[model samples]
Structures are given as C-alpha cells and as structure tokens.
Target: MTHPICRACGTQYAEPRDDCPVCLDERQYVAPGGQRWTSLKELQAEGHSGRFEEQGPDVFGIGVTPEFSIGQRALLLRTPAGNVLWDCVPYLDDEMVRRVEELGGIDHIAISHPHFYSVMVEWAHAFDAPVHLHEADREWVGRPDPALQFWSGRTKPLTDELTLINPGVHFPGSTVLHSSAGDGALFTGDVVNVGPDPRWVSIMYSFPNHVPEQPQKVRAAADLLAGYRFERIYGAWWGRVVTSGGEEVLARSVERYLRFERGE
Candidate 1:
C-alpha cells in the first residue's frame, strides 16, 4: 500500500489519510489542494536532490532537495565534542548519510517536539548514536522505535560536553540544546525562535500554524532560560537566529508573553 506525504510538513503516512495527524493539532495543516506522495525508489529515479546550507562555522540548515514551496529547515550543530542533529526530517537515505559523514558523523539527535521526530531511528542507526528525547514528551513520540533512548529529567548531557535544555514551551517536553559553539553561542532549537526582525527573539504556543501563546507558559519558559548568557540563538529554520543581544531579546520576548497572557 502506498502512503501519502503531508505537503505541509513533508511527513509521510501510511495509507490515504484525511489530514496530517501532526498538523491536525493547532500547529499545522495540509496545503489547500492536498499533496503528492513518492516512494524512495521513485524519488531517486527522478534524480531529486537536496542540500544543506552552511549557517556558521559549525551550523547548517538542511532543506528539501528540490526546495519545496515551504522551505522547512533543520539545524546541524557541530562541536568538538560531537555533532548534534536538531529537528529532523522525514526523508533520509544513504546519500544523506554519506554527506553527513563527510562533514563529520553525527553523535546525538535531539528534537524540539514529536512532529520533528521524523525518521529519527533511521538517523540514529546511520551514525550509531542515541536520540535524546525529553521524558515529558514520551507519549508524543510518533515512532517509539527501539533505537530511541528516552531520558527523563530537566536536562541531560549527551557526552559530558553537550547539554539539552527543556524549557517547556511548544510542548511540555519541548527542548533546546546549549552547547559551546566556539567563542560563545547557544543552539536554541525552537524554545526561542528568531523572529522576522533579526534583533528580536520570538515564541508562541503553536508554531506550525502561527497560533499565539498564553503569557504564563511563555513567562515560565523565559524564566527557565534566564540563567544562560547566549550571544546567539540558532533557531530551527533558515534565517532564524539572533547573533547579538540574544539574552536581552529573550527577556523582552518573555515580557511580551506576560502581557498577552495576563491581557494587560
């Protein structure tokens, strides 16, 4: 049986489904006219191509090979300790593995939420690495593949050098990773998204569909992150990182959330 892929997020599902289960929630949706599905062999036969864009010395944005209408991207943070694949995609193959290996084999895979848990097991096996998922979001795990090593607790160190932060934003277990990117930097998956304004940082209750959030949760998450001094925030997608004054922008974002939550 052939499955359909959600054009909204590029996630494939078995059989013909009404709507993307991942998007059916408040955060995402299918394109107006629906989507197209292609098998691995079929896609490869067409000579489809995808590539990664270098964002910084050790950061990259991985997008669709042909560049879909919606350029959804994920981050690949490389550090001396190891590499962290943040927010994954549904499509992965040997070619992708080879490319990643050329840059440096991945050591850890962490996602912001379950929706991004696409082909995670396949990814883990490719690099012989363990997936670091927050304990609070265990139920949301889409695959629950045996390869996943679920970890409970506020934070977990991948290799004594890398750290994962769960501020509880988009999801109860929605997390961000804070690793030393040379000089001084923090890789915030989506807990603190870089707004359209490069200088401003943003957050929402739901990001897939642009739904805003209540102030309480925003404030709490912000408070949780106040302890860190990050000069830059590496967001989930392309052009979503603030290079300077990131801490101040984070505090301001929290203030905005407080006002919205309290209706002030």
Candidate 2:
C-alpha cells in the first residue's frame, strides 16, 4: 500500500490520515482549500520529475520539477568520504535513484528539521542508508521506521570533516551540517535561512506565521557556530545559497536580529 503524502508539506505518513500534523503546526499551514493527500506513485504519474543542479563546488542540488509541496531542494554533498544527502524532498522514483547511484550512492542521510522530513524513509530504503535525525523532534516523524536513527546532543560527527550541529533555532531538534570541504560550507535546511539577498541569513520560529525566534536563542545559536569557518551557507530552496562569507553573514545576521529584538 502507498503511504499518504501531504499535498501541502510533502510529508508521507505510514497510513492514510485525516490531517497532516506537520502542516497543522505553527511553522506551516494547512492549505486554504484544506488538507489533501497524494502518493509517490501518483506524483510520478502526474509527470513530476527530478531536477538536479550544481549548487556549489562538490554540492549538487536535488529537487522536483513543478515544485512539490515545500519545494525545498536536497543537496548531495560529495565528500571524499562519500555522498551525503542533506535534507529530503517528498518525491522519488527509479530514475532519480539510478542517477544518484551513478554519481556514487548515498553514504548517509541527514535532515535539518521537521519540515524537510518529507518521505525520508523512502529515500533511505532506496539508498540503503541510515537516516540521522535529532531525538528531540522524534514525535514529529509521521512514519516510524527501523532505518531511522536518532541522535541526542548538541553535535554529532559524521566524518572527520563533517559534523551535525543542533543550534535549536526553528525547532528544538533543528540541525545544520558543517562541511570542511574547500573553504567550508554550512548546510542549513532553513534552520539558518539564506535570505533572498544570498548574503544574509535569518532565524525564525515560524516563517509562515511571521514569528521571530527569541533573541537569546538566536544568540546562542550564533555563538555555538562561531567555532566553525564556512565560506558558504546553503539554504533549503533552490538558488538560496550564500556563495561566500558564510561565517560573517551568520554573525551579522544574529547581531541584527538581536539589536532589533532589543528595540534598539
């Protein structure tokens, strides 16, 4: 049986449900027309195909054409260790799998937050890789699977050069992957949102509701990330990458956010 995928958020549940908990949350919203559901097979039949683009050096952006659900593209990080899939989309097919396999199949899968948790299990099964998620947001997972592995802590090391840091900005378990490739790059799936300007990043409790994250929380996140040196910030969507000065961009963004929060 096909799992029910949310038409709004793209999260696939183990079975059919009346509502999508992800969309019902404050960070997201249920469609004005109300909740609708679809399956991966249905999406494939509807002509939805894979979209792949080079986001940066050694970083390939993977997304869906015609933009399904949240429309956040996943990044295939090609490190010397292997390819790492940062974040996930709701749709996947045999062709997409074959293309990735040709480029060196995925070694591991990591998601930045709950919003990007769309059909992660499906992807894991396809690649036969482990899905690393923060234990804090375990409740939000729509589909429980044996392949899903939960980690607890402020940070977890995936490789000598790659580490998963939980800044706890957008969600309690919200994460960002710091890669020591080239100069360095931070893979943030809307956890540290890359602004439209491409040079600025922002922190938000809920983008859909226009809610600002707490100043202290933002400050703490920035402080924790200050240790790393990243020249680029990769956001969730296509073309939302900060090509250079990622570390400075994050520092300035936090200062700006806190300054405004203090009403200064």
TM-score of 2: 0.99
Steric clash count of candidate 2: 0
Question: Which residue pairs does candidate 1 place in steric collision?
Answer: 27-209, 49-65, 50-65, 215-261
Model 2 residue 258 lDDT?
83
Candidate 2 at residue 155, lDDT?
Answer: 99
Quality of model 1 by C-alpha lDDT: 0.70
lDDT of 2 by residue, 120-162 (tens): 9999999999999999999999999999999999999999889
Clashing pairs in 2: none
Off by over 4 Å in 2: none
C-alpha lDDT score of every prediction, in listed order: 0.70, 0.93
What are the models' TM-scores? 0.86, 0.99
